[model samples]
Target: MSSAGHLYLHTPFCGSRCGYCAFTVEVGVLDRRDAYTDALLAELAVEGERMGTLRTIYVGGGTPSLMGPERIARLLDALRPRCADDVEISMEANPETVDERSLAAYREAGITRVSLGVQSFQAGMLRVLDRQAGPEQAVAAVDAARGAGFESISVDLMFGVPGQTDELLDADLARALEMGVDHISWYELEIKPRTALERAGAALPDEDWAADAYERIVGSLEGAGYRWYETANFARPGHECRHSLGYWSADDYVGLGVGAVSTVNGRRWRNHAGVDAYIGTLSSGVPPTRSVEHLDEPTRRRERWMLALRRDEPMDMRWAGPPDHPEALERLVEGGLIDVDADHIALTRRGRFVQNAILRQLMEYA
Candidate 1:
């Protein structure tokens, strides 16, 4: 029995790929979109027959906005029965692809939240990232989406690019606030392997510099009335992404489509990475899973601690257990990576900067 409450659908097509992105995305002929949607729905049906009702569904993509209304409607139609009432449906969009009609169609199809990829307000920065949207187009997309009755809109911003200055970043932040989005995901630019940035030898700012930029970003958004709920994501009081919160909180989720990873119950599985392989597998009326791992009890407990540490909330000390290295937690406590209370251990604001180190310490100790 699947019985998962979270659903994630990955739409893998983009008009063009971003420079710093390494996700399993494809830029292909528009003619292939309909077939892609059909295959996605087929995957969803197979998963739904097992997973039952989902309380939240996130439709993320290379650019979901590029899909037409009918395609989106058809996909959602397949998803409707598997979803519970008050399902927090979310979709990631490209500012260049969303229009009034598309926004309306998404709202009508039960997408409650729209996250626009507006990496930077500066046209130069956008070009550096190979982004297709201009400042005007970004503004227009937000206006159109709000006009289409999407109350909870989110925008993504990037920092620490090759030539991004603090002044330019401040301008971008101000522009984002002026756009009136309820949520803002301010991400530092990281050059991952195989991405355009990595190939172009794009130099990322130093870790200290990135951390400083993040601090300033937090200050600016909070000053503008957004709450810093997670490390990269911020929102107005109740507008925090329920789906993402579920991710960091170690809740169960079902991920569908090529290259998607799902964690249901205690088992982790990933679908086939190649689109062709995924489609061929689905054509045989079988789930296109590529690999599966049933995590051991120790692995699960360790993962729970690591996942909980991502949140602003304290980690449960019960899971902390006896450290593999007796002095690890004590050293982190002294170094200020984490703080211990009566029943929980939590990262300090400074600790969040070097979260990987703290988690490594815990895992190494384990």
Candidate 2:
């Protein structure tokens, strides 16, 4: 039993398969949502009791919006008593599923933030990505969530798809800004192993193109008063997702439901990703966990460094490397890639582009 204040719950249900997604998700499983929620509550009763108290919770998913209002409310009812008074609760929803009624229900259930998955606003891009949502639904969903009393709203966008273009992405950013969303997740579309997109073999953009797209997005968002708070997250002032920040800060958190992962006191464990196997394990009176790891001090330190360097804030003094790092911090500072202060070290706008190479060089002296 540990007192981690952050929690993550995974719901592995989706209405249809998105071609580029490779997360452990089961499509067209609406009929089994009740049983799935029951298993989750059971896991909570057992594990949540050991989790001390919670300050933030993120309901991530194969699209949690698929669970609908009643089930979402029931899940929240179980979590309400255990949460701190000002806990930040975020739920992930898809644009197609984000109706007014559903948004209102989620707000009533204590969801303060709703992250809409609007992969691309272009019809051709959506078709290539195999998403059912259109551009209009994306706008309507954002408006509906704001109208439903959600204090914070974020939208997800993707780049490097087949039909993605500078003009298309620029328009998407403009639309997100026009809608007054407080947060934006602008990321490149990675073609991972075994994904439908990967299998189909349609050529996506090259690395250089993706890099250019990233720069354009950063410029557009920054011009609109959005800060690049993390590697792939941007937000207006006071709208940064605290739950997401917790991950970069390495705060202890407990994860629930099939395929969820948890970290408590430097120990890591992931639940079984298979739905039946997860439910069956719990039914047999054992935890549904499938794997575990104990992070040693060096690994933990390196992880802290990596995560910190990828964030928007300054690196804590404790996490900073030796007096002089291998990468020649002074040289990088001169080159305008990074900055160091008595209290913190942070990446500059230029450093964000080559973060991996810079981090590797710095870690050699860590």
Candidate 3:
């Protein structure tokens, strides 16, 4: 749309907030959903009027499935005009909220993909993470999506939680693969401040144990025929998420609704996190953008490299900066961490295990 073809809509309501979640989401606010959607529509209209046709639309949040069909329809109606015919329309849902009716409504509203947050398949693991859904719901959700004509579906799984072992995580992976979804995203649980997990003082897997589990999971997934396309994402050939790809590739996007962030025309901005403040701003005939960052070339380039290196594809060696940094690159390669060939630097299996550290080193050297 406009100069960019990506849009993100933030729906910040959930039945219950996950303990480890740091997203700016509100729980127990379904009563005010109608008003919230109205404000969101206003925000979308402003962005759509400025942006013409989008290539991707990602409706992500606390739990988008909790929104009724009418709410989803109204949001899509505002977005339809701003999207190209081949736009990849995707939404994120928690496993517990998905049902036949919701799945049917999503397809009717032009959703080409669905990403279910099925964090873990074990009932005990789910309880430890404060997730509402268990293994049965995760399996049923995937089945329902496929039955409802969704060609592309993805399941999100997390590892390295307290009391979780590599063997237990391996079982979760096997169950997910057996569910026949098109994609998988496996993430390790991170303890952030202000979360229930932190407040309860839950014990986490040791760093070395976490690393071992990650390595085992990666090798297991690859062995099971899933492609590790990005740091936390795997897919069956063509099922990689287009919306997320746009982000990792540093493509432009516009975010709507409260607490949503967007990068467009080389500038990044975030909507106001407060609902009343966001609604008030829109009532004043303007967007509720609370902060904006106009990224310079070096800043953009640095971000581009950082994001690109997350994929299996290598960063263009020409974009890697100085030749003298051979020491840094060589060290990473010799450690079985990365592969450097011709004009590209790609991650080896081990590199993805410590991707965050490697990227930090590259940024420092650059």
- Alpha-carbon runs more than 4 Å astray in model 3: 49-52, 317-327, 334-336
TM-score of 3: 0.93
Order of candidate numbers by TM-score, starting with the best: 2, 1, 3
lDDT of 3 by residue, 1-366 (tens): 336778888888888888899998888778768888888888876766546578998989978888877898888987787689899999998878888778988889888899999999899899998899988998899989988889999989998889997778878978877887889999989999999999999899998988888877778778878898998889989898988898888887888888998887777888768767777778766878678899887677778777888888877867645333357887888788888887888888777778878877666434
Expressed as tens digits, the lDDT of each residue in 1-366 for candidate 2 is 457899999999998889999887997667788888888888887787657667899999898999888898998898888889989999999988888888998899889999999987788898999998998998899989988988899999998888677788787777777887899998888888898888998788878888888998888888989999998999999999999898898888899988899888888888878887777777766788669999877677777888777797778756544422635777878889889887678888799888887777677434
Residue 58 of candidate 3: its Cα lDDT? 91
Q: What is candidate 1's lDDT per residue for 1-366, written digit by digit as tens?
A: 547788888888888888889988887756777777777878876777557677888988767787766887888888887778888999999988889888998899889999999899899999999999998898998899999999899999899988888788889978988887999998888889999899999888777777788888988888888887787888998899999988877788988888898988788999877777777777777888679999877777777776777778787777545444546878889997889877788898889878888777767534
| Candidate 1 C-alpha error for residue 77, in Å | 1.5
Local error of candidate 2 at residue 43 (angstroms)? 0.9
lDDT of 3: 0.83
The TM-score, computed over Cα atoms with residue i paired to residue i, of candidate 1 is: 0.93
